[model samples]
Target: MHTLAQLRAGQLAGIQRLQLSCGLTEFPPEIFDLADTLEILDLSDNALSTLPDDLPRLTRLRVIFCSANRFTVLPAVLGACPGLTMVGFKSNQIREVPAASLPPQLRWLILTDNRVEELPAAIGACTQLQKLMLAGNRLRALPPQLASCTRLELLRIAANQLEELPDWLLGMPRLSWLAYAGNPFSAADEQAADAATSIAGIPWERLQIGQKLGEGASGVIHQAVLQQTGGQQDVAIKLFKGAVTSDGLPRCEMTAFVNSGDHPNLIPVLGEVLGHPDGVHGCVMPLIDPGFGNLAGPPSLESCTRDTYPADKRFSVDELFGIACGIVSAARHLHQRGIMHGDLYGHNILHCGRGRSLLGDFGAASLFAPDGPHAAALQRLEVRAFGLLLEELMERCDLPAATQASLTALQAQCVSADVGARPSLEEAERLINSLRA
Candidate 1:
């Protein structure tokens, strides 16, 4: 949150990062002075319209964020930054993304809430590409060349105009997390289960909301009590802000949650909020048992596709088995109902110290038929995501040589390049149980 006054005074000299949101309408000349040391820059929430042509002078720059600006085109100068790897321009009016704007070293890219109807074929040249976010765009399809990004792990193409999922996308060897809920093809199918049927309407007046429990891109969760249900009982309530998130619509997420059904490792929806003066949407569920927290933090810019854990984090083989089995069970339940948990990262998982875990967050959930033609391919893509989680857990544990070998083999099977060759989550759960025995 650097101020223009501080930057001009040269007080931020030798800084590795800089952020200025003082209603900028042009690139600050003072920024060029930090070319030798600045590695990250954020100029979001401003009226900036363009970047200087010689923006490459920032030799050490590795990341840039210019979200919520007035740029109609991506600056070509970004491509000249040799070390740049992450870029974001979310919630802008940019309609054109020149081929020269994409850098070869790019990893995570965000272009959410834009009017982009197409992407350049040069996207295939970035073999190092990993996470890509293009939600809330006008894209009708993706360039087939994207399949060349075998290292890609997370993807979000929801809230677009796509008529069908790309065949190559279904075959991407590393694509794990996906969200395509708002597309015409899948949006129709997502309504298969009338949310009104699976979710009961509970009035807000019957509950007493308490302090915050947690918050995410779409809503805030809080501890609440149902006063009218015979006796007061503790529950968790999620009140949606009703915004278009990078994932998709809030109602779509609510639909997926309610229809996900009962599972040992799922935080099932017990009731849905109906009446509120402001018309805020919300849901009620059983309060989580004490002593549970997120398994990991969301991905960082440097580690674009993987979750990060604390330095002292460690899990024994038994605890790892329990965590793996719980996740596998929950996934099987979702897939059985033709639902895809698009955001399957460790950050979306909750775990107790003893290996018990639960999976939540439906913002990225998408719907398809269990017997649909694309079901197998979609499920296999999620298998790759699960494999990554297993890999992370395995790397943190000390186990016998035999046990380690077995776990590694199963993970390999899950993330196999050939989609059809990958084992189902059910099969993975079965093999994990054998390891436990």
Candidate 2:
């Protein structure tokens, strides 16, 4: 409650918490002297451009909220504070983040809605980081060193200008939650909307709906057989519920599928169908029938934990590598055509036949635009997700020792936290081919 004119040096000594949400254009340098006991500071919704260089003197500080500020650069001195754990700098004007400026003990770093172009490789030094929010930035790539953050769990880097994702992101065993969309490569085309509607026009009466294949936040998928086609096809029909129709997600997915054309390793979009009175909308795809003696369907990495399976039965490395190669090839083709499959994971990939894989699910695809402001950020997120997927595949012990080593090394190169450190899809393809040979 201290007035701006009455604020003094010794007045803040006993204050453990401070909220300066009003009438403060700048933080008085004298405040940093309170480092002896101050634990929390809230300077949000202010006009401040930069933090005081001496502010890190507060050794006891634990959390700092500096959202909605005009900060273009992070204070170098803040990294000197050993006790700092959480830092919120969302909705700022930050343009770059040098690795040497981060606090070593930081656990949660939120920097959403800034103009950051890249992340410093030194970020991997912060092994304690668990939750990182880098959404709405201008990053083009990620540093490879990020794989060192073994404790990281939640990473949200949506809404940027990414072209490709690296392979190492899948290795983080603790990572669970991830969200990346609105990238140039993942952008939806205007023409794709009509195609989605057309694809949704498939006749349900002409096909037999079998078991449920999968479900997502948007809709459910089912395995079905078409009597006219004379063969079974894996159809993922998305019934737009209460709100998705208006959100343009269905149209986006449709556009991506229609525009992507066809590939052997990609699920062919046969057609789309809609239900009467807006009850449902969906598309038809080829069914990947499980051969005799094989499991009903491929299990997600999460579902294959040791507790879920008998000790004697385990996933094989060769199978996982085959899946990885197929996905990489599909992604390579998509990127070459100026498209980005926003979401890439084991669940989105389907094993069509022996050594054959198909990349499906265009619900999150977008067009690639390298000149846009967000291009780099989008690519980094994709790389991160790819890294995570590769890590999951390499975890299979049944994979041959030599094969596992080769795949692991390739994944490590792709998932590098530094976006620039990640290898191009073409380079990745060569690596995979070498292993195949």
Best by TM-score: 1
lDDT of 1: 0.88
Give me the displacement of residue 388 in model 1, in angstroms: 1.0
Tens-digit per-residue lDDT, 1-437, candidate 1: 89999999999999999999999999999998999899999999999989998899899999999999998888888888889999999989888889999988999889988889999999898899988998888999899989898888888888889998878888888789999888888866876666434668888898898999998766889999987646888999988866567787787888889888889899988899879779888889899987999999988777887899998989987789889999988998899998999988789999997989999999899988899889999988888889989999998999899989998999999989788899988888899888888
Backbone clash numbers for all candidates listed: 0, 49
- List candidate 2 stretches off by more than 4 Å: 1-200, 203-210, 225-236, 245-248, 291-317, 352-354, 370-380, 398-405
- Give Cα-based local distance difference scores for all models: 0.88, 0.64
TM-score of each candidate structure, all chains considered together: 0.96, 0.51
* Backbone clashes counted, model 1: 0
Native-referenced Cα lDDT, model 2: 0.64
Question: Candidate 2's residue-wise lDDT over 264-359, tens digit each?
Answer: 667777777645344566777765655412212333222421112234444455566576677777877776555667657556666543455667
For candidate 2, give the lDDT of residue 166: 53
